[model samples]
Target: MKTFLFRSLFGTFFGAFVAVVTTISIIYFGSIEQLDSEMFLRNSLGSIFCGWFFSVSPLYFEIDSLKLPTQTALHFITVTICYFVLSLGIGWIPFSFPTILLILGLFLIMYSIIWLCFYLYFKNEAKKLNAEI
Candidate 1:
């Protein structure tokens, strides 16, 4: 219970941090001309939820019956939907067929890179632990 609460709070804070960073990046790149308070608030909240969901997504691996590939695919699909919808709502990506496919392609590439990094790191750590044992 305590760990769950910690993860929840940590996820929320992490989400907020990601949203702020994203806002800064957008401003730095001048992607948008202007952002009124209402839109900013909505986008910030949406981004926070996106980050929170992404952070907690690994919990899906806790399901004993699901293999690693199944967990990975489920997590990927769920987060992709969450991110795609949030991006559309926040105007980060336009609503068009080509643009949609582009965004998804980019997301898949990034997700795969991140997943591989984590997998390799954990695999190394596991090997080290086994060697020590």
Candidate 2:
């Protein structure tokens, strides 16, 4: 439990860092002129909180040895639900079914790509280890 909490703390810090970078990049590059500084700050904090929540929440899942497909699916579902609910709760996204579905679909695609990349990287590393053995 101590280890898990430590991991969660590390993950949350990492996630917040990523979120801050992302927010800065978007504000710098995307250059949304309509949002005031206060609004931007609020959005940035919301994103950081979301990232931290997401990072820490998944420590409870026991899916390390699960099949790749099952693990990916579970992660995708869990993240999507958490993100969607958070977005709605924070008014980051409007509470509309169609919009929610659209965001979910996009998130599914993004998560699938992420899972595939990690899967391939780990599989290759395992194969290399086996070759050495």
Candidate 3:
């Protein structure tokens, strides 16, 4: 839908911007002798596409009144699949068992950390609101 496209487009540009900044930082701080401009451009665009795809995927989680756990589970499953597929397609991740397992493990750790942070943030906000009432 429209919202999906909007989110995807936003992510595409943001991801590309981040990718460029990261590359620039690396190049500024260290030598990237083997990396040519063409390769860099190609990789940047690919990353943008990956980001767009990832963003659009969240549309599946937009159902109203769903339990938090259900929403989280859906998001995790959708994003994992989307990330794996797009990463492999873009040559960011190789198609291999070891690589898949490694990626999944890292994703799991990061996902848990992010969710915990969100939970804590919302809990604090709720406490503040209750105090004001």
Whose TM-score is greatest here? Answer: 1
Clashing pairs in 1: none
On residues 1-133, what C-alpha lDDT tens digit does candidate 1 reach at each position? 6666677778888888887887888878987778778877987798778767876877887788999999999999899988888889788899999999998999889999999999999899999999999
Clashing pairs in 2: none
Task: Name the regions of candidate 1 deviating beyond 4 angstroms.
Answer: 21-35
What lDDT does each candidate get? 0.85, 0.72, 0.81
Candidate 3 TM-score versus the reference: 0.76
Better of 1 and 2 by lDDT: 1
In candidate 2, which residue ranges exceed 4 Å CA deviation? 18-45, 57-65
Any idea how many clashes model 3 has?
A: 0
Question: By TM-score, how accurate is candidate 2?
Answer: 0.68
The digit string of per-residue lDDT tens for model 3 on 41-94 reads 767887787678777765655677887789888888877887777778767888
What lDDT tens digits, residue by residue, belong to model 2 across residues 43-62?
Answer: 66667666666676554345
* Candidate scoring better on TM-score of 2 and 3: 3
TM-score-better candidate, 1 vs 3: 1
Which candidate's lDDT is highest?
1
Model 2 lDDT vs. the true structure? 0.72
* Candidate 1 global CA lDDT score: 0.85
Q: Could you give the candidate ranking by TM-score, starting with the highest?
A: 1, 3, 2
